[model samples]
Target: MSAARGGLVATLAAVLLVTGAGCGGPDEPGGGTITLPPLPSTERTTAAAPAAAVYRLSGNLCEKADQTPFADLYPREDAKRLVATEKLCMTRRTSAEKSVSLTIDADLLPTEAAAKLFVETGRRLAKRPFTDVDGAGADAYWDGDQDDVKLTSYHGNLVLEVRAAVNVKDGMPDDVVQRLVRVAEGTYAKLAP
Candidate 1:
């Protein structure tokens, strides 16, 4: 072929290649610069579904009760309606040994009753001396002290109490206590009323 003709063909080929890349032509596998559906708004706008509120109460000793009233332990205004209640307790081999108990209450609607019960029970148990034992697991007790107790109420609504140091060999099984707590909490969450 003539030199002029060959040069013309080369120039045309280069132009075509540049045009194809710019336009994301068929030559490109998945087209060009694919833009994602405008990245989800990072702005802290309101959530589509609001998350449920969670509350934690700890280090509440009986001694502090004198300074802080039972009503203050769980403020009425913060209390949410009762969603459910869970009770857990541990038993000892003999009747003489002390038992420990724990309770957790959940609130669905949120109410003052839930908060009152939680604080009242906590104060009542803390004021009483609770014995501590070695092999009790989460809720163990000894003969010397009354027994260890823990109560947890959720959203200031549900109330759960754990009572330990009961007769284990003949009385309720340990597993039953856990099941009761779980069932009660779930039931309260459902809010039958």
Candidate 2:
């Protein structure tokens, strides 16, 4: 072997001896045990769950709302109206094809538990057929029977209502109902954040 290779082999042999490695014979050194460094782990790691979002109750729900979702259905916003100290905001938008109205009513209770109680009580008293909707807000529902699409949700101390005016139609179409759901979600973002 080259001088360099020979030197390397000699160094390795010395290290093996120091580390209690055997000389490859029945008569071995130490306990004839060899301990190698641990190999890299092959276990897969999974991502943790996302943190839940806490939505704030806005005083003026209309101002913080994102109207982009329903802009196509209702192109123009009606004349400005007075907002009740951010407690209530009624945003009315109209287009040649349809007119839509979204009402956000908020009641700031002293405590979050009180707010929840009030919302739950109101829901119970509604009596009307309500279909629970997912992800509209903390709690959400829609009218089971209606000529036009209407969706409602409660977040914190605020209740959001998205209503579409289609009185002439015999019943609400699927597209209209889906549109209302989207509108409710978009409006909830504004009113509850």
Give the top-scoring candidate (TM-score): 2
Q: In candidate 2, which residue pairs clash? A: 59-86, 60-86
Per-residue lDDT of 1-193 in model 1, one digit per residue for the tens?
A: 4555755766777666656557744443333433222323324223474444333333321211111111222222122322222222122222232322222323232554555555444433454433332221212221112232232333333343333233343343334434333433443344322
- Per-residue lDDT of candidate 2, residues 1-193 (tens digit): 4555755766776687656555444442212444454322323113454444345663555676555666776789877844534566667677776566655455556545565676666555565645666766655666645555566666655556666554454334456656666766776565543
Could you tell me the TM-score of candidate 2? 0.56
The deviation in Å at residue 140 for candidate 1 is 17
> What is the number of backbone collisions in each predicted candidate, taken in the order shown?
32, 2
Instruction: List runs of model 1 lying over 4 Å from the truth.
Output: 1-151, 160-172, 190-193
lDDT of model number 1: 0.33
Candidate 2 residue 122 Cα shift, in angstroms, is 2.3
Worst 10-residue lDDT window for candidate 1 reads 61-70
Model 2 has how many clashing residue pairs? 2
Positional deviation of residue 120's Cα in model 2 after best superposition, in angstroms? 1.9
